[model samples]
Structures are given as C-alpha cells and as structure tokens.
Target: MARPPRFDTDQLLDAAVRLAAEGGPAAVTMAAVAQAVGAPSGSVYHRFSGRTTLLAEVWLRTVERFQEGYFAALTDASPPSGGAGGPGPDPARAAARAAARHVVVWSRAHRDEATLLLYGAQDFGRAEWSEEHIRRADSGNARVFASIGGLAADLGAADERGRDRVVLALIDLPLSLVRRHLRAGEPLPPHAEDLAEECTAALLR
Candidate 1:
C-alpha cells in the first residue's frame, strides 16, 4: 500500500478550530489552517473545496460532536423506577438537569469547540454552505428541538409558552452561564455544573 498522506481531514479541521478559537471564523482561511497544521495549502484544498466548504465542515463537525452527547443526556434514559421501595426521583427532572449540566461540563472539556458554538452558523458562512451541509445543520437542530419538545410534554407543558420554558431551562439557561464565563476569557468555575443543574431543576419544577 502507498504511504498515508501526512495530514488528514481531521487534522486540518482541528487546526481550523484552534484558529477560530484564537480569532474568529474569519481567521480560518485555507492558508491559515494549512499554516497552523504545518501542511501545504494543497493539503487543505485537497480536503475542502474552498473557504466556504471548510467553514461549513468545521462548524458542522463541532456541532455534531456536541449534540452527540447533548442528545444522549437529554433523552437517552428511562425514568428510574423507585427501587421496590418507593417513588424515585423524577426522570424528566433528572434528564433536564443532566442536559443543563452538560452544557457547562462539555464547554469546560471542549473549550475550543465551545468557542465555535458561541457564534451562529451565519457567522461561519452558512449562507454559502453547500446543500448537504445545510441539511446536516438543520437536521441536527430539528432532532434536538424534537427532543426538547418531548421533554416539555413530559413536564406537563400544555402550550407554546410551556415549551419555551423547557427550551429556556434546557438550552438558553445553561448556554447563558457558559457564555458569560467563556466571553470573559475565564475558565468555568467548578460550581458551573452544579449551578446549571440546579437552575434547570428549578425551572422544570
């Protein structure tokens, strides 16, 4: 077999992510990523069609990675049955708490990726993304929104406002906390997870 090429897609994307974290989306040009990875511009161009595609790929990759864990925390568990003794803690509440905590925990763990999230897809050139990239972004969003809706129904949310409350508790609230610290250029405090969890539990209640 032929020897493997020195740089791969992920390596370039990781470099792009770091560049984005340092500056912003505008900083992630093909040459910039190639330079960051010590790869030739040809290596970057070989994987990405152009800057638009590269931006789309990096944005989608970060989002998909985040949603993989987030969706699991939001909807992957059945309510715990009270151990042959009595009623246990509410699973809906537990999931809500977990989802909220995950925002801070994940951001702390993936600071660079989290930085990408701080900006909207538009900031990453969504308008120029290919159809496939757009679909991937939309699909991930739809799935998460559907899961949030299901959680809201479980919590007895009978109207749009109620669902909005779930959205606030599950998404907006946790993200707010993370945004505050991240924008300040500070690491999330140890209590960040607890605060997110407690705030979510309170909203759900």
Candidate 2:
C-alpha cells in the first residue's frame, strides 16, 4: 500500500502563515518557508506548484479560517428561542454583535495575517483558481453586507443604497482605525472593540 503523506498540510501552512505574518508576503518565498519549517525545499514544491500557488493557498486559507470562526460565533450567539422551533438563536442581534466582535478580535489576534491579507496583492496572473475559492470569498463578504442591510432596514435606512453605505462605513472605518494605529507604531487603541460595536449599533439605528 502507498504510504500516507509525511508532512501535514496544516503544519506547512501554519509555518507559512507565521512567516507571512512576520515579514509580509515578500517573506513567503519557498526557500523562506522551507527554512522556517526546517523542511527541504522539495517538500514545498511537492505540495504547491509554485510561489503563486503557495501564496494563493495561504491567503485563501487564512480568509476561510476567519470566515468560519466569525460565522460560528454568530451561530453560537443566536438566541435559544424562536425561529421555526429550531434550537438556533435569534440571528439578528447575535449576528451583528458577533460580526463586529469577530472582525475586531480576529484582526487584533492575527495582526500579521490581517495586514498581509489586506495589504498584499495575491497576483494569480490569470491562473484560474477553483470556483469554490471565489465563492467562499464572495459569500463571506455578502453575508456581512446582508447582515448590515437587515439591520439598516430594521432601522429604516432610506434604501438599499443607503444601507450599503452604512455597511461600508461600519466595516471600513474600524479597519482604517486599526491600520492607522499600526502605521503610527502605536499599540491598538484599547477601545477599538467598543468603537466598532458602537459604530455598528449607531449605523443600525
């Protein structure tokens, strides 16, 4: 029987994540990743075709992980009552709070990954990736917008366009705030989470 693969894909990716986090995408060359993981360069090539493929995989994996955690938190925060007799929590408030907290907490916890993802452009160079990857990114973004739209409608925002503006403001404002702190070489503002939550609430209202 053929033997199973020796190195774990997750382990390799974790090392790559740390490297990218510490040194940016430019630090994620195959040689660098291999050195970081103490693995032979051939191992990286065996798993990924090239630098583009490896970087794409790392970027997509990081985004997916964040999305999964945020969505799970939203589900968990759901109210224990209502909604078709299912045990799931009421999604409205829970979803909003969870979304806000998720972005703030995840960004702070993985500042390197966040910075790499937001700032580093993954140059696919016309290489076609799996449709699933595209869908995953789109769907996660859509969910955030949908949640914001629902909240805006609840608060009687003038229209869909108005709701979209509010959504953009809520999401982008916090990220910009964090980016400013990082750029200034200052510690993240202690009230960052509070600011996000308050901004989200106000937009919804």
Candidate 3:
C-alpha cells in the first residue's frame, strides 16, 4: 500500500485562502502557501502548475462553495406555512429572502472564503487562467444568472429592469453588506441575516 503525502491539495488550498484573505491575491504565492502550511514548496507545485493555477483554484473553490448553497436557496419554491392554517408565505418571496439571507449567513460562517469573493476573478489572475478554468468560472456565472432570472419571473418581474432589481436584491445588496464589514476587518453583526432578508423582501415587493 502507498502512503499518503503530508500535504494534500485541499490543505494547500486552505492555506492559500488564508493568505489571500489576509494580504489579497498577491500574497498567495506558492512559497507563501507552502510556508503557511509548513510544507515544502515542491508540495505546493506538485498540486498546482504555477501561481496562476493556484490562484485560479482558490478563487474557483471559494466561489463554487458559496454558489452551491446560493443556487439552492434561489431555486427553493416551497413556502412556509403561515400560522396554523393560513396560506403559506409567498414561495417566490420566501426564496428571495432565503437567498438574500444566505449571503450574510454564509459570509459569517466562512469569513476567509467570503473575503476571497470580495475580489473579482480578474484580481485573482483570471486573464492568465486556462481555458478550462475560464469555462468553470463562466458556467457558475451562467447558472447564477439563470437562477436569478427564473426567480424574477416567478416573482412577476421578468422585464430587464426587474431582473436587474432581482440581481441587486439577491446578489449585489447582500454582498455589499458583507463587503463593508469584511473590508473593515469587522465581524458581521448579529442582525445581518435578518437585515438581508428584510431588505430583499422590500425590493422584491
């Protein structure tokens, strides 16, 4: 039987995430990641082809993790029962609130990964990414757009402006709330999720 190596891909990626979160993309060099994880620099290179690939992996991993839950939240059409026997909460609106609240809740839960999201793929060296990496990033983006577009239609706002509003309520607004606090190196407040849900409900109405 073959023995496992000391540093695995996810371990290195985790170190890269912390480095990127603390000092931005420029800080996530192979040497820095290796040093952060107390692994040989060769171990970092063993998993990723170069700094560009490392950056790409870290960015994609963080984004994909965030989006997995976000996509689900946006697509949830089931509404909560209102009181004991009243009609349930509006399914579309409930989904919108859930999706919006998910942003803050996720950020609060994954602060380091959330910080990675504040910067665009371009900031993470996307221009140098492989075609495969580009496709992965594009695919995630297309899914998000489709989910939001679908939700907008369900909420009776299928027009372009209405879709834009959905985008704002679901993506831009909640992210803005997270960005402000993360950039300041402050923790998200206790009411962040409630505030996100409330603001989203107001916009979707």
Candidate 4:
C-alpha cells in the first residue's frame, strides 16, 4: 500500500490561518502556506485547486469552527421559557450575554484562526468564488443571521430596524472589539466578558 502524504489538508489550512493572522489575506499564497508547513507546493494543490479555493476553504473552515461553538453558546444560554415554570433572567438578556462572552472567549482561545477570520475572510474573495462556494458562504451567513434574528425577536426588538439594532449590539459590536484586540496581537483580558456584556446591555437598552 502507498504511504500517506507528508502533510494533510488541515495542516495546510492551519498554516494558511497563521499566515492570514500574521499578514492578512495577501500573504496566504499556496507557496507561502506550503513553506509555513514545510510541505511541498504540490501538497497544497493536492487538496485545493488554487489560491482562491484554498482561501475559501480556510475561511469557511475557521468560521464554521467558530460558529459551532458560538451557536451552541447562544442555544445553551437562551433565557428560560417562563418564570412560573423555569429559571433565569430574561432569555434575551441571557442570550445576549452568552453571545458577547463567546466573541471574547472564543477569540482568546483561537487567536490565530479568529484573527484570520476577522480580517481576511471577506477580503479573500468570497464574491468571486464558484457558484457552489458562493452558495455555501451565503448559507453560512444566512444561518448566523437567522440565529441572531431570532434572538433579536425574542429580545423584543420591534421590527427590521429594531432587529438591526439588536444585531449591531450583540454581534457586530462585540466582534469589532475582538477584531481590534486580535489584530493588535493582544489577548482579550478576562474582563472582556464583563465589558462586552455591559456594553450589550447599554446598546440594547
């Protein structure tokens, strides 16, 4: 039987993430990723057809990984259904807090991937990708919007304008904070959770 290749797809993507984190999307060429992982250029091409495809895979994989945990946090921390029969404060508020903490905590935990995602994904040409890739990207975005949109409704946001405010408060604002810190090569402080939660409260209020 033939022996396995020296490097796997995940390792190449991981190297791409590092490159993206260090120098943004412009640095994530196939040669660069292969060099970072000490693999032959052919190794990268074995999995990804070219730079755009490789970048799309890298962006999609990192985002999916992050969203898995983020979505879970949102679900697990959703406010209880009824005070008479369940426990907890307002579900919307609880969900908001969970969402906020996930932004900080997840970024701190996965700094390279998080940094790459925050800075490079959209820049790496999702718009020019193949139809299937575009569909995948669109669907992923739709799922996130749907999840957060539901949360906004549950939070008593009035309509589309109100939902936009809720999303800006809970998702965009916290993510902006994380993006800034990650790009600066700084770890999010332990107090980031508290800061995010407090800010979310203020924004929603």
Candidate 5:
C-alpha cells in the first residue's frame, strides 16, 4: 500500500503564504517552501507537482478563505425566508454594512494572502486544467458580485451596473490604499477604518 501523506498540507500552505507575503509570489519556490517547512524538497514535489501548481493552490486557498468570511457575514445578517435572504431594511441593511466593513478588516488582516489572490492568475499549460480553473474563477466571482450587488440594490443603489461599480470601488479602493501604505512604509492611517465605513455608506446610499 502507498504510504499516507506525512506532512500537513495546511501547515505547508501556511509557510508558503508567509513566504509569499514577505517576498511576493516569486519567493514561493519549491525549495523555499520546503526550507520554510523543514521538509525535504522531494516532499514539496510530493505535495504539489511544481511551483506553478503550488502557487495556484495558494491563491485558491486564500480566495476560499476570504469568500467564506464574506458569505458568512452576508448570510448572518440576511432576513429569513427572503430571496437568498436579499438585503432589506433594518437588520439586513445593517448586515450588508457589516459585510462591507468586514471586507476591509479581512483584507487588512490577511494582507499577504489578499494581495496574492488579487494578483495571481492561474497558468494552465495543461489545457483542461486551465479551462476548468478559468471557468470556476469566473463563475465564483460572478456569484460573489451578484450577491453584493443584490444587497446594494436592496439598500437603494441605482441599479445592477451602479451597484457593481460601487462594489468594485469599495473593494478595490481599500486594497489600493493598503498597497500605498505598504509602499510608503507608513502605518495604516488612524482614520482608515472610519474612512472605509464612510465610503461604503456613501456608495450604498
């Protein structure tokens, strides 16, 4: 019988994420990951076919984690017996607001992973895997945006297109702000959180 896997995939991924966060995606080589995890290079290969695969996995995992938190916040605040619990007044609006807030908070907390996921693209030298990855990513993002847009419309945003623009603005602006802060070697602005909250409220309103 084949030997069961020894090292934990999550642990290895954690190390890989740290390396990428510290040194960018190029730092996540098989040798680097192996070194970080104290595993043999062969073990890295055993876990992933190669560097591209490892990078793809890292990006996917990070996105999955972010989506989980986002969806949870959306669901928690949604009204029962509604369409996908579409955002409504009172608690639903509050929940949508909270979800928007969580997006910034989560991005800040997982800056490295968020950065990688935002920028990483899957390479499918293998045609089948490439197509599969593209389809899944496109579909997943559409669903996420649809949910966000629904909430925005419910909260009185102009229309689907308008809501989408607002969602993109809210999501991308904070990321850009974070990137700028990091580049300048400055601390997160004292009013950054409040600013993001205000931005969300204005865009939604």
Candidate 6:
C-alpha cells in the first residue's frame, strides 16, 4: 500500500487562502504557503508549477465553489416555463431574491474565500497567466454570465440597459455589501440581507 502524504493539498490551499485574505494575493507565495502548513516548499511545487499556477488554482477553486451554490439559487429562483406544460407561478422575482440573498449568506460563510475573490485575479497577475489558465478563467466567467442572463431573460431584461441593471443588482449590489463588511472585518449588518432582497426585487421589477 502507498503511504499517504503528510501534508494535505486542501490544507495548503487553506493557508494560501487565508494569506490572501489577510494581506491580499501578493502575500500568497509558495514558500509562505509551505511555511504556513509546516511542509517543505517542494511539496507545493510538486502540485503547482509556479506562482501563476498556484494563483490560478486558488482563483478557480474559489470561483467554482461559489458558482455551485449561486447556480442553484438561480435555478430555484427561476420560474418554470408557462408550459413545463402547465401554468406555474412566475419565478423571476423569487429567483432574483434568492441570488441576491445568497451573496450575503455565502460571503459570511466563506469570509476568507470571499476576500480572495474580492481581491480578484488581477491582483494575482491573471493577465500574465498561461493560455490554458485564461481559458479556464474565461469558461468560469461565461457560466456565471449565462446563469445571470437566464434570470435576466426570464425577467424580460431584453435591452442592454435592462441587462446591465440585472447585473448591477444581482452582481454589483451584493458584492459591494460583501466588500464593505470584509474590509471592515465586521459581520454583515442585520439589515443587509433584507436590504439585498429588497434592492434586487426593486431592480428586477
């Protein structure tokens, strides 16, 4: 039987994530991650080719995790077609509400990961990433837009301006709230959840 490795991959990623949360992406060096996990630097290199790869993995992992829940919220919010073959309640508003509230719920639950996202891949020098990494990033972005676009279409945001508003309420509003609370190192305001729901409902209506 093969001996298990002493250090776990997720342990290393968690260290890197916390480092980014505390000091931003510039803080997430391979050496730093190794030290944070009390492992040899070679262990990190064994899994990641270089800083770019590490950062890409970090960003992609965070994005993928976030999208899982977000996609579900969007789906739950969506109103089934007037004929899934019978009339049903319109779900556009409910879907928008779920997506909006989900942002706050998710950020609070994953505060450290949330920081890494808000810090953004740009801070990790994503522009200099290898083509493969860029493709990965683009694919993730496309899925996010597609989910939001589906909701926008359901809500009848047929014009560019209308779509933009959907983007603003669903994406910008919730993220802005997360950013503020994350930067302050404070919990989300009690009203933030209700406020997010109300705001998205207003925008989509």
Cα displacement (angstroms), candidate 3, residue 121, comes to 0.1
Per-residue error for 152 in candidate 3, Å, reads: 0.8
TM-score of each: 0.94, 0.74, 0.94, 0.89, 0.76, 0.90
lDDT against true structure, model 4: 0.80
Q: How much is 202 displaced in model 5, in angstroms?
A: 1.9
Give per-residue CA lDDT, model 2, range 43-156, as digits (tens): 889998888777777877887777776656544546423222233243555455556656777888877666656653344321455566567657776875565666556445
Clashes of 4: 1
Model 1, range 51-132, lDDT digits (tens) per residue? Answer: 9999999999999999998999889555323222122267787777778878888999999999889999999999988999
Model 4, span 65-94: residue lDDT tens: 888877876766655232122334676777
Model 3: CA > 4 A from native: 80-88
Q: Report RMSD for candidate 2.
A: 5.6
Query: Can you give the lDDT of residue 134 in candidate 3?
Result: 100
Q: Which pairs of residues collide in model 5?
A: none
For all candidates in order, the CA lDDT equals: 0.88, 0.66, 0.88, 0.80, 0.66, 0.83
Worst 10 residues of 1 by lDDT: 79-88
Q: What TM-score would candidate 4 get against the native?
A: 0.89
Q: Model 3, residue 167: what's the lDDT?
A: 89
Clashes of 5: 0
Q: What is the lDDT of candidate 5?
A: 0.66
Q: Candidate 1 at residue 77, lDDT?
A: 58
* Highest-lDDT candidate: 3
Report how far residue 160 has shifted in candidate 3, in Å: 1.9
User: Worst 10-residue stretch by lDDT in candidate 5?
Assistant: 79-88
The model with the greater lDDT, 4 or 5, is 4
Instruction: Give per-model CA RMSD.
Output: 3.3, 5.6, 2.6, 3.8, 5.4, 4.6
